[model samples]
Target: MWGLQPFYIPWYWYPCSTVFGSFFERWPLNKLELGMPRLGLLHTGIVLLLTLITELFLKQLGLDLFTTTTGPTFAAIWTTVGLGFVWQFNMWPFTELSQPTKGIVASIASLIISVFLYLVTVFLVGQENIIQGLYWWFNILWVQVFLMAPGLYDGISLWQDVPPLVEEQQPLSLNSEGR
Candidate 1:
């Protein structure tokens, strides 16, 4: 577990591996190695993205995302939400993007999804019990969401619906002589 500083992180997901990290990092350095500016611009851009997302709650005062709070807890929730999308799900709708771009876009997309989720939760749970409702959402319900989201997007169920094994069939012998 390295420090893996993400400007705004060490990382993990329900299904996680260094393969995702390596793919994004090694490729960027080899392909888009723009000196230290790469670090500066990339990091700064992501930080700004975080700030902008946070502003959605901070500015509104009363509004907040699916996250617990609009501070560090918000960052934690955003990271948790993005991991399943970014890693297990292969950053859908942005998979064609380069590694750096994919990471950035998918992250912001996750934050957007969080906002959407907040609205949904509020509508369903109502404002009266928001704190308890969000707690249930992030802690309990999101586990199932993480497990299924990728499969749902990819048109598969994690527990695939297929036979476990197939019986071997004898090969048909062709009689070319008859033809």
Candidate 2:
């Protein structure tokens, strides 16, 4: 269950970027040409996989690192590092910014967001209410879906009808006048 926590945050963060970007015409993964929600799901899936693997590795190493006091902090740091790499590798390459500028900005932004989320989680879901607090956090994350309304509305208006594919003709005609 703890392994699943990191997965929830990205669902909120990415869609927020997407919904907001739709209004401003600025998207995070613009090169992919995918909907922001779709990108968010992909991002969440990747983060979840990495987080679970890292957790398992730590457990195997007998680190005993995820005490209540350390668990959120570790989660935040892991989230920051994971997202920084993801944005740098996946989104940054497609942007107009220079490599160093993009890398530094992305790193700092990821760290800030991770720390903010961590602090908010800690405040709202104090140590005694760990499970309950996580539940609330998950609930808050889902609120991001509401941000998709404008994008969805615009998409509805911009919907296009695609023509059906025509079947290919045989190379040789069955009833040719010339042999």
Candidate 3:
């Protein structure tokens, strides 16, 4: 239970990017001397493994209770905080902390932010209406997240390398031998 994603999808990219992305950026992972390719692979692996483990943990424990009670187990807030850490604050105060400890601190901070946002929403909407037809919220959130998609940034960074399409005068090559 990735907590109310469409069809209860657990491997959703947003939450994984938000939580694991920031977590890995801290301490020991950041200290690694890997180049761009290796670092990217490591980041991908860390996010995937953690996301799978979290999905298993959530499903095993039936964390769906947070679904009806709170939206996506406050995943939206976690995304907000996680993105804020990197894009906005550049992971400030936590920068001073050591490796694993920094990661722990960042995790705790995100959790705190999630809880605080949850409380604020509950206070405003009241407990009774927490789950009442709020699907639109996530729909818009999806688009918002899409605009910030990591691939877009990568493409922008590598714009000079983007391949151009074949010219109309260039006939198609049907096979390896150019038959």
Best by lDDT: 3
List model 1 lDDT by residue over 32-147, tens digit each.
Answer: 55678775576445445545545554447555333334333343445455555645665567778876776557545775776676666667767776655547656743674567
Q: Which has the better lDDT: candidate 2, or candidate 3?
A: 3
lDDT of each: 0.49, 0.45, 0.57
Per-residue lDDT of model 2, residues 2-114, tens digit only: 67534343333442333223222332344567877897687566445544554465456332234443344434343433333343234334246554455446544554565
TM-score for candidate 1, please give it.
0.43
Query: Candidate 3 residues 105-175, lDDT tens each?
Result: 87778767756766676677766776532343455456656655454322112344568776457567989
- List ranges where model 3 is wrong by over 4 Å: 1-7, 11-13, 26-73, 131-179
| TM-score for candidate 3 | 0.51
What's the ranking of the predictions by lDDT, best on top? 3, 1, 2
* Candidate 1: clashing pairs of residues: none
Q: Deviation in angstroms for 179 in model 1?
A: 50
Predicted structure 3: lDDT: 0.57
lDDT at 97 for candidate 2? Answer: 55
Give the number of the best model, judged by TM-score: 3
Which regions of candidate 2 fall more than 4 Å away from where they truly are? Answer: 1-96, 149-179
